[model samples]
Target: MDWKTITQIDRRYLYIILFIFVSIPLLSPLNLPILVGEHAQAMYDTTETLSAGDIVVCSFDFGPATIPENRPQAKGFLFQARELGLRVVATAFWASGGPLGEDILRDVYGSDFPAIPEYGTDVVYLGYIPGNEVGMQTFGDDTWTAKGTDHYGTPMADIPLMQDTRAAEDLSLWCEITSGTPGEQQVIQFVQGRHGGPAALPLVVGSTAVSVPGMMPFYAAGQIVGILNGLSGAGEYESLLAGAYGYPTELLAPLDAQSVAHVIVILFIIAGNISYVLTRSSGGKEK
Candidate 1:
């Protein structure tokens, strides 16, 4: 093809090709092997260390826009927690996160796993609280005081899971699945900061790709124990869940699609470079 044609390839054609590259994997996943990152492994290890009956406070800090990336990490964490017989006290700093947590719990309990525990006793949803950072501080001081009722409006005193759990100090671990601020920072300031000495609550985070860079410093400093970043992180967590607990690999279709899509984009860049070089070389020969 001429230099102009090679360089000015129709955008429509590129979109079509991109669509195919992304869609084929969704339809029939390649099941490509993913090298799990240290962050995800750390998350797994941190979770595995929790003993049964330990109180884990999970904060769904992201809105629906980030569900694709955040949901899998939520499922992976919850699955591990449930399998290990951990008591999960779920809440949300963001208003929307409450229902999202509820949906996650419903899916997990409704799944084929027969041994999954019931909601109130094993898992409790505290729903959303207002006042952002201030609300986080309130929860850190006293969970029932901040959220008087569960998502269903039942008094916290009536919930079986809330009977003994009262504040951040009672939590064995804190897991935050977030896409924005008032996430790791708030958790650190209110929850982790309030606890005395070296016995601070351990925290793990699952964040969107856009927010992962900012959270790395905390991970490095050991303020946050583990991180699950974007879709790739979710995929790695999924792989861990499958290998560790025998969950289905088919659940990783999004991860497979992501891998193929990335490869396709990289290939396109290489092809474009090759075409440009060849076109220039041909022009030089003709001259």
Candidate 2:
């Protein structure tokens, strides 16, 4: 057939329409039913186990690239800590994480939830510490000495929250939300390994989906307590946070839109397959 005839036969417009159809729903979320994953449930359960007056170290080990997946996990953990009246001490290894960490704390305690935990008393930001494994080692050794000042250059000793925090052992629990290389290994080698059995403190993790497979080894070894991986995991956490702490309905719209977009994508895949088979069986005829 001529190029003109081929152009007439081709249904490229269908593909274009499907793309827009999928994109629109994503841009405008639907707030569909959320099914919790086993990993997320474990993280949630572990977080709930914490009691009032406990201390949790939130180590933001990932950069801005992972904010979408890692941010919600941080939110869930922070609120859980605050709800139980637990003291939170947040720090980061990645420089980019500084802003991301602040944004998360502000988002949860600032507006959507709108119940700011007592800043100096309830939760405090230790900011970004430069050294990777060495930093983790030092932190496990002495919290204040390792990080002398908070993110804003305020002395840790002056911060009421940092008063009792000396080492990983002093904290009730520790969570490392990591994406790339250093933090997870650092936690395993320095914090989890350096400290004895119960003194080691429970370690929870939030990582990208691609990193989850590699992270399982640590989980199986009983090094890490819990894990939340990728966007799906984040979505479940968002639902959980919204349920326990109540999110603005507007904030959840994107999650619903994602659900609809996923269905639309699946439908397009099945339809494409069926069309391919029918076209092949009809001796390459265009109908």
After best superposition, candidate 1 residue 46: deviation in angstroms?
A: 0.7
Best by lDDT: 1
Q: Scored by CA lDDT, what does every candidate get?
A: 0.83, 0.75
- Estimate the TM-score of every prediction: 0.88, 0.80
**Model 2 Cα lDDT, one tens digit per residue, 106-165:** 876785321344777878888888788888888888877678888778788788888888
**Model 1 misplaced regions, further than 4 Å:** 3-7, 111-117, 197-199, 271-287
- C-alpha lDDT (0 to 100) for residue 206 of candidate 2: 83
Worst 10 residues of 1 by lDDT: 109-118
What lDDT score goes with residue 82 in model 1?
88
